[model samples]
Target: MRLIDADKALEKISKMIDYCEKDTSVNGLTALFQVGDAIMDCKTVDAGLVKRGKWKFTGTDKNGDVYQCSNCELKIGLDYETNYCPNCGAKMDLEEPE
Candidate 1:
């Protein structure tokens, strides 16, 4: 379970945004936006991880729904389900808990 470097992720996102601003291709811009979103999500997750402690990131809740950032592969224990990866902002594909 590797931890995400929030500073690096944010820096990369900034660069991606700059490139998107100059890019003219619709497809390229769309791709950049996706990447940017993931980075932002990663930043948020990292912050939480740092504030809460390492155990929180790795521990599973009673419900057994683990939180993971697909883009950065940051896994954490979460009590509830979320639509996006807190670490990379990627849309979560995990099945909903019953």
Candidate 2:
């Protein structure tokens, strides 16, 4: 699923309702008004669960190359870089110097 700015969408819907009101030929605008009200009553979603982070290369060892997670500083060896951190569940999608 995808997220969108509810307020902006509501504004557009409100504009459409106003336009419908001004134009007598336009019909079936009750649903548009209901959509705006529904948006106002909807709950907001945040990015709290999607913790952003990046993996920094620390060094190499006899075992293999090492990298550290920026968010939790959890260290791991090479070829183990997953999308999310194992320790803190931070998504390793940050664009920075590796």
Candidate 3:
């Protein structure tokens, strides 16, 4: 949940691929390239679910308080009978805050 611009991340990874192609002196660049590409990969994993309108929720806060999302998909599972947001409405499905 790094909350980065997806297209920008893709663009950066593309540039890195090209840079890796042209540079030969840095043997460690491959690891860097993999890590960069992994960022893009992770960014895409939950995107489709997000686009479909399924929201994941966070059950904790910045102050280290913890909660149990009784009605959340991550909690008691998806049921249409609940009126409250799961995960304490912390917006798990929402993009990470900028």
Q: Could you report the Cα RMSD, in angstroms, for every candidate shown?
A: 14.9, 6.7, 13.4
TM-score on alpha carbons, each prediction? 0.30, 0.57, 0.31
Give one digit per residue, the lDDT tens place, for model 3 in 1-98.
Answer: 55656676777677767776787764675658675665766443333322212344344455543433432444433333234454444333333347
lDDT of each: 0.60, 0.79, 0.50
Put down candidate 1 lDDT per residue, 3-92, tens digits, no spaces.
Answer: 677687877777777776787564765876777676656633343432221212345667676655645677766766566666666555
- Minimum summed lDDT over a 10-residue window in model 2 is located at 40-49
Q: What is the lDDT of residue 5 in candidate 3?
A: 64
Model 1 alpha-carbon drift over 4 Å, by segment: 27-29, 32-98
Instruction: Please state the error at residue 79 of candidate 2 in Å.
Output: 1.4
lDDT of 2 by residue, 26-89 (tens): 6576656566565765556554567989989999989998999999998899687789888899
Best candidate per TM-score, number? Answer: 2
Worst 10 residues of 1 by lDDT: 47-56
Question: What is the lDDT, from 0 to 100, of the residue 94 in candidate 3?
Answer: 37
Which scores greater on TM-score, model 1 or model 2?
2
After TM-score superposition, the amount by which residue 2's alpha carbon in candidate 3 deviates from its true location, in angstroms, is 3.0
Clashing residue pairs in candidate 3 (N, C-alpha, C atoms within 3 angstroms)? 56-92
